[model samples]
Target: MRRYTVSTAVTLCAVASLAAAMGPASAFPAAAPPAAHAVQQQPAPPVLVDCLWKPQVHPGDFMLACGDGNSRLASLRWSHWGADSAQATGTNLVNDCDPYCAAGTFHSYTVTVRLDDPKPWAKNPKMQQFTRMSLVYTDGRPDGFRQTMTYPLWS
Candidate 1:
């Protein structure tokens, strides 16, 4: 099967910016003016991807799905405007999957995204609305495989 490469930052930024630009600017609040000598502004958090699924899911079911993709449970960190940021890291996301699931086998690679964010999740600029993440596996050799999933941030 043909292989697909992860989108570049330029492309992703353009797409994200374009999509957001078309919508309402009132969504993401303007960044407070930076202070002089304030260590360079940390670039907006990378658009990470953990999983996207149906509206609701049982904890056990979520773990099972992650395993199917060769991932394990992992914490998800997100915060709304005026709220402190938090992380759902260090969980067994897909590591528990047997990797030999009965699903169709692929020679190259693939990434399936499952967004579980709250309904009408705000794409706010004042806070992180989406998380960036990826998955790794073998390429049938010593070298490994990498796939990234980037979701847009909402207020």
Candidate 2:
């Protein structure tokens, strides 16, 4: 047999011609059209689960101390509530246990709150909740706490 060599471009052109000969419809199946009555549903925004395991969006007040009400967020005004993150300006109400936790004094400090790292909620797998919380104390922070504190949010 005589020596024959096929170039890469020639092979590609041969395959392309074959595909084109078959027509676009035969080469690629048409996608099914959406139903006429199908209503597009927007996904729910990211949320925070409260102490009682309740999903909350733009909550006015959320208790940080789930057990004893020692620390909590109050008067929250959310500036951003998106799919990836959320932010708010609020007051961190921390109780100072002068005598004891039972007879502690609650103090309010201005704070900026940020929520991120959204994932499927543990209790409710269908919904998404923020897994990380960051607080920046604008005025003052609680004793034995840093100015900027980052905590893992409860699922």
Candidate 3:
């Protein structure tokens, strides 16, 4: 009886090991690529125009799309605005960090963005620009946060 039990236990262990090495069977079919004609096409490019004033109530949010795909204002809210400048706050989402930005993790910082008066764009006489932007962090600033950014309004 003792010999029979030992042999049965050894046989069961060998069968279990073989099954583990073989691995489990797939439950689903493999994925197939879409046909050339069936694949969706890219959309049209964004229209370039003068930046017009879009009304927003106090503490309203907005996004700034920088032409260069690396950086963007994820969201912004104005606390106050006057003829010369506007006091606002927002998150700057950037993809230009170390170790390469694309496919890497995007970092976000809580910031205060000061939007100054529209200045004439030298390249285009008819276009106006956001003369300056000052970004201040309330907290959680990434190492790359520049306190201020000046520019031609890409958004």
Highest lDDT: which candidate?
2
What is the TM-score of each predicted model, taking all chains together?
0.23, 0.74, 0.47
lDDT of 2 by residue, 1-155 (tens): 12234566678889999988887776677787987569877789988999998999999999998988999999999999999999999999999987999998999999999999999998878899999999999998889999999999987
Instruction: Please give, for residues 47-139, the per-residue lDDT of candidate 1 as tens digits.
Output: 322346332221222233443565343343322212222233223333322354454332332233333332232343443333322332222
1 or 2, greater by lDDT: 2
Weakest 10 consecutive residues of candidate 3 by summed lDDT: 43-52
Q: Could you give me the TM-score of model 1 versus the true structure?
A: 0.23
Return the TM-score for candidate 3, rounded to 2 decimals.
0.47
Q: Rank by TM-score, descending?
A: 2, 3, 1
Mind giving the per-residue lDDT tens digits that candidate 3 earns over 83-112?
A: 456777778776644576556566687888
* Steric clash count of candidate 1: 29
